[model samples]
Structures are given as C-alpha cells and as structure tokens.
Target: MTSHGTTTEECSPTPPTAEPATPSPGLYNADLAPTARKGRTWRSYSIFTLWANDVHSLGNYAFAIGLFALGLGGWQILLALGLGGVFLFLLLNLSGFMGEKTGVPFPVMSRIAFGIRGAQIPALVRGAVAVAWFGIQTYLASVVLRVLIVAVAPGTASWDTNRFLGLSTLGWISFLALWAVQMVIVSYGMELIRKYEAFAGPIILITMASLAIWMFGKAGGSIAWSTPATKTGFDMWRQIVGGASLWVAIYGTFVLNFCDFTRNAVSRRAIVRGNFFGIPLNMLLFGAIVVVLAGAQFKIDGKVIESPADIVKTVPDTFLLVLACLALLVLTVAVNLMANFVAPIYALSNLFPRVLDFRRAGLVSGVVGLVILPWNMYNSPAVISYFLGGLGALLGPLFGIVMADYWLVRRSRVDVPSLYSDRPGGPYHYARGVNVRAVVALVPTAAAALLMAFVPAFHAVSDFSWFIGAGLGVVVYLLVADRKGPFAEASGEAIAVPSKR
Candidate 1:
C-alpha cells in the first residue's frame, strides 16, 4: 500500500517481446504463486483460519496454562496475552506489506537487507528453528495418537514396557504415524494446505468449545477463578512477563514470513482486517477459553492439565471419544504444516534456488526435524525458553532493519529483478556482500537479549528483550549507516520503478 520512490508513467509502448508470454517463475517461485493483480478474497478467509488453527490448538492451550501457572490471575494472564497479540498484529502487518509490495517470500525479501548471497543467514536461522519445532509438534501429535490407539485397542498400552531409543515401540509407531500424516499433507503444497486449514480450524474450535462446556458441567458449577497453586507473590509478575515473552517469541518467528500468504491478498486492507480478527481477537478469546477450562480442570481433576489430549482422556462418553480423536488428529496436522513445514521449505529452497525446489526443501526440512528428536528438546522448560529467546532476539533486529530500509531508506519502491541479480552493480550488492552497519547493530542487540535469557539477574530485561533488540537495531543502523550523499541515492534507486512486472 505504501509506494516508495517514483511512480510508473506509461510510455509509447514498445512492441511486446516475441518470446513466450509465460515468464519464468524465477527465484521467487512458489507452489502458490501470487498473481500480479490480486483476485482471491477466499485467501483472506483462509489466512484468518490459518491464525485460528494456530491459536486454537494444544500448544496455545498449554501456553495459556503455563502463564496461569506463573502465579498470574486470569485477568493478568489475559492482559499479557492481549499485549503480546498487539505486538504480533503490528509485526505481521509490516511483514505482510513486504509480501504485497514484492510478491516474494521471506527469504527472497531478505536479499534487500542481507544481500543476495548473504540472505542465507536469515534463511538458515529461520529454517533451523522451524525444524526444531516440526519435530516437537510431531512428537506431541504422536502422543495424541498413542492415546487414541490405547483407547481403541487397550492391549497396545503393553508396548510401553518394551522401550527403544528412549521411547516405547508404541510411541515410535505413533510418532511415525503422525509424521507420515503431516508429510502427506505438506507434500500436496499450498492449495491442499489452504483447504486443510479451512476445514480443520472450525472442527478444532468446535471440539474445544464442547470440551470447555463439558468441563464446566463436570465441575458442578463450582469452577472458581483461582490462580495456579504453584505461583506466589511477586513471582506472579515474573511469570506473567515470561509467558508474554514466550508468546511473542512464538509469533515473531513467523512474522517475517507472513507476507508469503499476504501477497495473495485481494488488498492490503484485507490483510489488515484478517490480522486484526485472527491475532488479537482470536488469541484473547482462545486464552479466555483456556483459562476457564484450566480452572474447571483444577476443580474437577484436582490438578491442571495443559494438554488437550490429557484433558480429553478424562472424558468417559464413547461418542466424545470419536470426536476428540478426529479433532486432535486434524488440528495437529494443520498446525504442524502451517507453523513449521511451509516456512522451512521456502527458507531451504532460497538457499539454493536452482537445485533445491520447494518439495525438496520440505523433504530436507523433514529429515533434519527427524534428526533433532525434539521430544527431548521440550523436556527442559528452561532450555526451550532460552532457545526461543535467542531466536526471538534475532527477529527484533531483523524486523527493525528491514522495516527501516523499506519505509525510510527506500521509500516504498523495490527492484524485483535486481533482488535476484548477483552482479556487482545489483541494487542489493554491498561491499563483501553484507551490510556492516546492520550487522553491527544486530549482533550486539542479539547478544544482549541472549544474555538476559540465560542470566537470572537479568530476568526482568528478558521479558522485554525483543523490544530492546529491535529498538537498538533501529537506532544503531540509523546512526552508523551513511544515510546521506551517495548511499541515499542508491536507496532511492532500489525502490524506483524502472520497469514493472
């Protein structure tokens, strides 16, 4: 929506080229290529559902309970979630703008800031994080499968006694089954993903609502709004901040790539409206449901159960069993593909455009995720938090630098071809193929955030590390980077419409 440099002026049209009208998809190729002019309004709906699938799931529920466990009251936890969602909404809008402007994926867009060759740094950072999450989500889905299997075939629980590679035979089978389901869905690419999300999101929402209702009934109208027993005193604020930080970290990873979907939007307005409904409103509502359900569980079961599978296991009705299994299976697959699979596929493909196509990149990501065995990764909360903190720290600086360059430095224009061109005179080319000022700002800010993550003395700072890193990056780049003279001219050229796609 924001135009950067000079506007295009029609000239006495030259004869069209004799070559075939079908241009090569080039470096920005995707399974769902964005149209030069948008048409799909359904895409806005699909994206809205995408966020719903993201927020109305096991991970989201667990995160809410985790916040409550921090000693924060329901109101405080809701406030934290609301604040985190506000940040997420704004970040997504910026990232979405990039996609709409460039019609490129996250990795391709990084070329502006990181240089064409150097773009791999952000790609690898995003890809590695995706792979880690992929494995963890896969393991979680497998746990759901194991539950269903034992529910149907009661003797299958005996397999738990015979362990291999730190898991039972049943666990391995369940894990593989879940892995296979996700791989199959993702292999179909974005169209299938869109359809899957549209359906799965509603089903998951319905099941969660039903579960919440049933949980309330089981609690005998005595579900008091009480904080988790584990938290105490000022530690409640500490916990609330920690929960907010984790929420930001989760959303920040994908914020960079949000434009991948937004590029297909009918208009920037659609993207904004979708984000408003999907992020803050949806997350807050889901958080409220989670809090109510968690409180109900505490009253009914004598403890808080974060996992939906764990909560559903307490239900006795045979009819409910069928619905719960179906809901969990569909929801897990949806989240795994949307949140973890797609981004990494694009990230890896960007690393080597010619050889590694989207499908190959997806396979590579899946294999790497298998290597991590992320069930082990999520075993330690502190380690998981630290890892998330490190990734989140990078996001702020990256966002700051990219947004500043596009909005302030370049105005709004982007040279699409030059983004892929590797020659010396290319718009993105810089000395030694990296922006030193951006790096200088990014590195120290990330270091500061990481220090906060690991050091108990810096605990207060840790909660706001993303903001700190991002703000510092913006300030440092603005001050140190040569914004006057020749550099300013180059910045203008980068965005000017020399030609149109």
Candidate 2:
C-alpha cells in the first residue's frame, strides 16, 4: 500500500518503486506528486533569468514609465519599486518554503489547510484569475507581434487600421498566431518552460539595455532624471507608498502560486538566491533603465512614450526596430508563460488529477485565454481595476490561510500521505473531506476585501485590499482554529524529503 492507507492500484496507475513515500491515487497523480530531488534541476540562475524575463516586458515598461505621470521622480519611483520588490521577495520565500521542502504544488500544499476536497475552492479561484491574465498577456503580446506583421507585410497596413471586436484584423491574426505558439510551448511541459525562460530572460534584458543605450546616444548622452511634474514632501511620500502598494498588487497572482515553480528548485538556498537577484535587484535595475529611457524620450519628443513597442517604432534603423520588436515579443511570451500560464495549468490538473494531465490542462487554459476577448478587458481601466482588485482580494485570503495553518496551527508538520488520503479520519480529511472552519473563515475576509474593491466609496483604501484580506484571514483562522480536534497538529515527521533517486 502507498501512504494514506491506500493500495498502489487505487492511488496511482503505476506500482510504487518506494512504499509509504509515494502519494495515493485519489489525491496523488504523477503530476501532483512530490517532485523528485533529482528532477529539481532549477539552479539560482534559472530563477534569476525567470525574473529577468518576467520583469522586462511591454506592460511592465508602461507601468514603470507611467509612474512619472503620478508625479514621482526617478529616484522616488526606483525606491517604490525596491520597496515592492522587498515585500514580494519576503512573500515568495514564505510561500516557496512549503513547496521546496515538501516538493508539492500550491494547490496540493493547500490541502493541508483547506482539506483535500476543500482545496479545490482556492484552486478554482486562482485558476479563474490566471485564465483572465493569460488572455490579457496574450493580447498585449499580440500588440507587439502586430508590429512584426505590419513590417513584414506592408500591404497589411489596411488590416492593422480596420477594427473588429475591439482589435484590428492584423491584431486578430497576430493574437491567434502567438496564442497557438504558446500552446505548443506549454504542451512540452515544465522542462521546456524552464529552458525557454532561461534563454528568453537574459536576451530581453540585454535588448532593453541596448535600447536604453541607443536612447541615451540620441540625447547626446545626458538626460534629466526628474520630470517637470515631480513632487516632493508629504505628497511625494504618499505617492511612494501608493506606488509600492500598486507594484506589489501587480504581482498578487504570482505571489499566491509561486510554488508551482519553486517545487522544481534544488534547495531553499537556490530559491532564495534566485529570488534575491530575480526580484528586488532585477526590478531596480530594470526600473532604472526604464526611467532613463523615458527621460531621454521626453527630451527628444517632448513627452514620454509609455509603450516600449511604440518607442521601438520610432527608431530609424530597420534592423534595430525589428530586433527590438522581436525581443519585446519574446519578453511578453516569457512573462505570460511564467506568470500566467503555469498556475492555471497546475490548478486545472489538480481539479481532476485522474483525467487532466499537464498537456491537457494547458489546452483547456489556452482555449479559455483565446475566447475571453481579452483586448476588450485590457482596454478598460475601470474594468481592469475591478477585475484585478476583486481577484486580488480573494487571493490574499487564501495566502493568509495557507501560511497561518502551515506555520502556526500545524507548526509546519505535513503528513504527506494524509494530503492525498480521502479516507475518513485522515489528518487532512476533516469533516466530509472539507474544512468548514476554513470556509467559514474565508467568507467574511474575502467579502470584506471584495467590498473594498467593488464599492466606489471604498476606493481610497482599495489599494490595500490585499493587505486587509490577508491580515483578516490570518487573524480569523487563528481565532477559529486552534491546535486541537478538527484542527489538530499533524503527527509524524515534519516533512518527507523527496527521494534523490
């Protein structure tokens, strides 16, 4: 019998080579099982490049340059990015530790807190948001791809100008083409993703640096760092805080399911080392380049062009323009796959471990991303706000509950076998395989956060909706669930390290 008191036949298709350590059939599938240490080949540089590509993208470029519009100087904006990066680094570490130690994905780790069946709730919520982002990122990447299409086929200029479903005919072709390519990439699974990210991240990082150098040369090598609207004193501090909050909010989705990648990490040290260079340092370095480019553009054009693709188009050299466009396209795809693709793929796989494997789940996610008509959603500020903010509120609570339960209530002990066990009286089984207290705790906290997002009266504090939900989620879970009875501490070894074999 495998662990969780089930025979190997019931829990998995293949008989176990090692007894007790292997996960069960119902909750355990090859996709969700603990990753073998031998398979954990992602070094710190793999992770660093992952962040490098993730940070250097069209949307991120726009976000960084647009901060000047908020009256923040270059220094203040860099400071804000740094602050957000620190918060993001800390959160990724806390969430990643569970995965690195136990070698499980986020949805699987959630079982320890939400019960086996109940884990589906958070999984589905995260999946929905991921699907939305997948579509949005695909649309954004298509915008850059349109540049290539237009450049290659000058006759398609008419196609670019004509509009349908809020996107031009050229836009549709580009979006669908990029969409198909990404599906093929995901079909190959995680190893391909790791390798692709390693290649894509550093190339785009160099491309952006080159673009910055070109912009500086255009401006005779000297540019003003501060904009005309730069603010100071109390107003500056307020913008700094808001900028920091917005920066963290931008990554709220990745923060929740970071373990999807960390599970492949070779060690806790690898995870930390990668995240350090990947997040804060990389963010600051990229932000600095963005500031310099924006300033140089303002000097030449009398206004900053927020879209990097648009900036690329202004270049007179055909080769550099094509190269920059291709680099931006690759950067967009890198972030989309790394930030938006993996989470939903794993979430859907966990939803029906028996029926859906990685490739199949990726197809489902890709289809959903295509049909969402993401261009419409991405074009609207109010809609994006409500959509992302509402989802962020819901996600924050899940993070809070999982962290609180794992670190505080259970003291990090995980009966790995119990996570897959559907049997009554199993450690994670709870009442009817559902943790009602967790659901009960989730309701009010999520509701409170959602209200902050949806209600206009609460707009002032909506930026902090994630913080509110997470804080309330931790407090409420601790209040309702102590280490006794249904919430008893896990008994057994604290963790079963994944086999090196």
Clashes of 1: 3
Tens digits of per-residue lDDT for model 1, 1-501:
333221121211222222212313344343323334433333457778988888887887887887665566667778778888988888888888677655566777777777766777777777777788889988988887787888888898999778776678998998888887777777766667788888988888888888888888878965746644656567766776667767877676778677656555656666777788889998888877877787887777667676777778877975678679879888888888888888888887876666676667778888888877677787868657777546756877776776776666666556565565555655566755566666776677677767766788987677676777667767777777656523221111222221112
For residues 283-372, write the lDDT of model 2, one tens digit per residue.
999888988888888888778777777778887877777788889888988999988888888888888888888899999999988887
Worst 10 residues of 1 by lDDT: 5-14
Per-model C-alpha lDDT, please? 0.70, 0.80
Q: Candidate 1 — which residues are off by over 4 angstroms?
A: 2-35, 38-42, 228-245, 380-389, 485-501
How does candidate 1 score on lDDT?
0.70
**Model 2 misplaced stretches (Cα beyond 4 Å):** 1-24, 161-166, 380-383, 485-501
| Model 2, residue pairs in steric clash | 11-25
- Candidate 1 residue pairs that clash: 4-412, 4-413, 413-495
Error of 1 at 209 (Å): 0.9
